[model samples]
Target chain A: MNWTVRLTVNGEPHTLALDDPRVTLLDLLRERLHLSGTKKGCDRGQCGACTVLVDGRRINSCLTLALSLDGAAITTIEGLAQGDQLHPVQEAFIAHDALQCGFCTPGQIMSAVGLLNEGQAGDDPERVREGMSGNLCRCSAYVGIVEAVLDAQATLAGEKERAA
Target chain B: MNRFDYVKPATVAEAIAAAGAPGAAYLASGTNLLDLMKGNVVRPERLVDITQIKELTRIETLDNGDVRIGALVRNADLAYDASFARDFPAVAEALLSGASAQLRNAATVGGNLLQRTRCAYFYDTASACNKRAPGSGCDARDGENSQHAVLGWSDACIATNPSDFCVPLAAFDAVVEIEGSSSRREVALEALHLLPGSTPEREGVLNPGELIVAVRLPAAARGFARHARYLKVRERNSYAFAVVSAAAGLVIENGSIKQARLALGGVAAKPWRAHDAEALLAGQSAEPEVFEHAADAALREAKPSGDNAYKIPLARQLIVRALAAAAQGTPSRMPALPASPFSAVPGALHDA
Candidate 1:
């Protein structure tokens, strides 16, 4: 069943011709849209490797059918940055050395962004660990992942203060 | 995922019509359904995505003080709602305790309640899973029975219900409001999930055309005994499936038991409400001995599988601890050490 889905991706409007009902938003983004930054790990929604923002809320793109999201806005890891500059979360990941194999880095960043946007970034390590538990890093680099999220919170707060 | 026809139904009537059709399934969040389809556990010819129905997305308070949670309410939203936290702390805790932040964000309340078992055999096509293929055989009965059901399990299947939210909801006497092709009716949350008796294939009582519009919790807020807790013991502290879990809600009035509601999970085919234990607590004084007796009553009927015998003791201990903690307004003991090699390190960060 082919359907025409008009939605905004990373602030740009797009009209895609989606033919397969089984093809998910993750597939559309990676295969059709050529946005390969969002990696697919488990594809069963167990792994958070395909996490993305749907209307600014974190969701497993692998679990979301492309036809279901007709007019929904999507933000993938490829859309996280403006021009050459990285998002605060991306910068924090680099600063804290949060990645090893880097396969799950995009998902981690996307989930972190969603968490931070929800104003759930807390100072407690346990709280951060629980908040970021959705995105799995097979490299087992969680200590750095926690540190990166915590660092991102500080950076984002500092930026907010500067703007204020 | 196999190719399938998808229809986005914007109204409850449309959804019900589609669901009534042959080989059609309602798509709430796609957290469980899509996963099963991709794994070849369930191959429906048509998927009716009901998330677009605006009526099923609202969460409101009824005049009777009962909370009405739309089927489309995301687990994350329900977990974080201030009203849900205050009125139904158990529900909030259960939602938070299940899955990871990302999964919760995508998983709807209805989808969580309807999620299939996490048994490896059910997921693997090569293995025999009666739930996936009726009368095929349950490989988990002999293969990896550690996480299989210890209660309400038949010879045909022993896969445990993987939902964390339904346990607390069942304990609180939640009601499921369903809209069917012919009529609409409300089914108690406990009755919403069926036990795996002779017909292990039938998971719920909802008809083929029924669409769960909302989940309504009964207005019995005062009965929350001094101790009410949901204890989830799992392989990992976070992001792992529970090996055995218990939800205890007791009402202690003047140091005497007014009412008690106990439900067990991970060790049962359904969110098992301990009616015998609740009956034992009736008119009894709140004490360690009473809690012990109640736990014993609950475990008396338990028939554990070979590898899942540990769950019997674990469930009993959890019930006692949950009651003790709730009595004192705090959980007394930590979760038991995970038997699996992937045990979560205490106070350490592990990705879900």
Candidate 2:
């Protein structure tokens, strides 16, 4: 059986013909749309290697079925860059060297960006750690990842201060 | 994951009709169901995706000053809601203490409650599990039973319910609003989860073709606003299953205990409420000795397996510590201080 799912990916509308019920958004993005930036490490919800945004909220794409997200809006790692310019989260990740093998970098950056947009990046490091515990890295590069998130928060705060 | 038929129903009636068919399961968030399907733990022939049902996703206030939480409310949204934190802090804390932010955002309230046990044998198809297969001999009784239940166990199954949010919900006298194919009825949240007396395979009392509409919490402990805390002791500091956890809510009037509700998780087949302990603490003076006595009374009937005997003392200490902390209105104890930069545990850390 095939289901027609209409959803917004990045900033564009997409009407997908999905067949398998168990085929997740991670599979759709990687296999169908050729957006292979979202990696699948564990292929389970335990690892956040396939984190993406649905309706502006971060979720594990590996656990989400593509047919269940009809009329939903999604944002992948490819959507984070504005043509030539990088998103603040991506720039911060690069500046802080938050990636080693870079397999889990995209998911980590996307989760951080979602957290920041959700107003979760605060002064408390414990809260930040609790919020970012979903995404895992094999290289054990948590210090750099946490630093990047904090730095991006500080930069955004500074920009707000200048605007004020 | 294998291919299966999918139906996205917009109404509860349609969902019920679909679920009544052979080998059909209701899907809300798919956080746990999809994971199990991918692992071949559960292979339903048809998935009735009910996430699009708008009526089941709302959070509204009832006429009785109680909050009615729809089944499809995301864990992340419930944890961050001001009303949930103010009224039911234990629920918010438990939800926040469970999975990471990304997973929580994807996990729904109903799915979290209906999630299957984390027993290794249940996941391993080679191992015999009664919950996974009827009349299949139990392998967890003598083999690798560390994470198995200690309080409620039959010769058949020892798998523990994995949801942390359910402990507080059980203790706080919450009610589950369920709509079945025949009629709709409300069951107390404590009664919703069944104990593994003999039939460990039947986890809940929900009948076939039944859909959980919402969870209703009654107004009971309104005065105990600040004197409540949820303590989850897991392997790592975050995103790990509880080794032993306790949720305590105490109300003290004139420096004496007026009321108390305590529940233990990760040590029981269901969210084990300490009704005996609550009876022991009622109308007693608020003191360390009383809390210790209550903890002792709660564990008096606890029968643990070989490797899980440590959970008895660990749960006792957690109960006492949580009660004392709640009485004093102190923040939850941080096992390990957070390091400067945010980092997930380097590898899979075992429970302490």
Candidate 3:
């Protein structure tokens, strides 16, 4: 019993036939679609290493079944840059040295992008820290992660103003 | 995860019909169910995916001022809903205080209500948990049970419900709308979960195939919007289950407490609504003495099930602290940390 799921990944449409209903979004993206930029941490919802933007909202991909999301728009870590130009959050992470091992950087950047899109944190560092608490860096890079999120938030705001 | 059949139903009727199968379970966002499945704690032969049902995703306010929250509404969405937050501040705070932002964005209200306990024994397949395997004999009674239940637990099971959102819903007397195969009915949120008595396996009041369609807050629940608070004490500052938590709402008139609602979490098999405390505070002044008596009344029947006796006194103090914060009134905006004790106003704990 193969279930078909249609998803738009990184602005590309993909129609998949899943033979196993147990395949999670994390597995589908990494093993099937070969988008390994999304890391698999705890596999449980506790760790946010599998975080991605699903329809413009951040969610844990490990806990989400691929079959259930028939028409979701998924934005993974691979989707964050245009040519060589990194997204604002990606650039900010590098500018702030927000990664030591870089294992959790993709999840952190995707979550930070989602946070900036939500626009609830504003410029407050406390809010940014609280909002980004989901993505954990075992390197204890939280100081840099928080700074990067705040810096990226400002960059995105400025870009929006210039476009307007 | 074990292999399972999946069926996405487009309507509530179809979903209930699909779930009528013997080994079928309703699947919302799967934030909790998938985790349990991966741990081999729960394995259903069939999953009735109800995520695509558009009717179950709305948060509508009725003309009579009652707010109806669809069962599929995400935790983050419900917490950020402006009018929903304004009318039910404690519920919003509790929602925000729950799991990480990503989990909250994917976890639905129905999934949160039906989420399994965080009891270590229940998740361990090697352990003998009556809740997991009926009549297997409870191992939590003697094992590392410091985080077990302190109230409403029996020898059969000592697990506590670990939902921050449910604390405030139980306090507000929220109603759950259930759609059965043939009809629909309502159950009080307080009565939705059962205490782990002799039969610890029976967790909720829902029939096997009945689906929780929505949760409704009555018009009267809005009366406490001005003075409501949800306070949680966790091992960490955030992203952790409550060691002991409380939701307090007060309706004060001219410094006199006209009505009060209090409920305790992380201390019982179900959300422990403190009705006696609510009764004790009515017509009394919002003073420290009244709060102390109410807190004591709230924990009157709370006896520890294991080495977790510390939770009894901790829950009592949390009740008092939560009530005192409520009397001071809800903040104009939710604190950056939501319901964490660290988010409390400076010196509030000392004053309490």
Model 3, residue B328: C-alpha shift (Å): 0.6
Which regions of candidate 1 deviate over 4 angstroms?
A: A162-164, B222-227, B330-352
How far in Å is the alpha carbon of B23 misplaced in model 1?
Answer: 0.6
Tell me the lDDT of model 2 at A30: 94
lDDT of 1 at B44: 89
Retained native contacts per candidate, as fractions? Answer: 0.81, 0.88, 0.86
Q: For each candidate, what's the DockQ?
A: 0.63, 0.64, 0.70
CA lDDT, every model vs. true structure? 0.82, 0.82, 0.91
Off by over 4 Å in 3: B346-352
TM-scores, one per candidate = 0.94, 0.95, 0.98
lDDT of 1 by residue, B1-352 (tens): 6777888888999888888779998998788888888888889888899989998888998898888999999998997887666667666767878888878888898888788888888889999877788888878877978878888888888888998898889888999998898899999889987777777889999888788889988778525723666778887777878787777777777888888888887988789888999999889987899989999999998877758788899888888876765666422221122111122432223333
lDDT of candidate 1 over A15-50, digit per residue (tens)? 998777777899999998899999999997878999
B200, model 2: CA deviation in Å? 1.7
RMSD of each: 3.5, 3.9, 2.0
Report the CA-based lDDT of candidate 3 relative to the real structure: 0.91
Query: Total clashing residue pairs per candidate?
Result: 3, 0, 0
Comparing 2 and 3 on TM-score, the stronger one: 3
Q: Which has the higher DockQ value, candidate number 1 or candidate number 2?
A: 2
Please give the lDDT score at residue B289 for candidate 2: 91
Candidate 2 lDDT tens digits, B1-352: 6667889888999999889988888988888888888889898888999998999888888787888899999988987787767777767778878888888888888888888899988888888988888788789888988777888777788888888988889888888999988899999877888877667789999987799999887777545666777787888778888888888888888888888999988987788899999999989987889999999998998877647888888888888887876787623322122211112231111222
For candidate 1, the TM-score is: 0.94
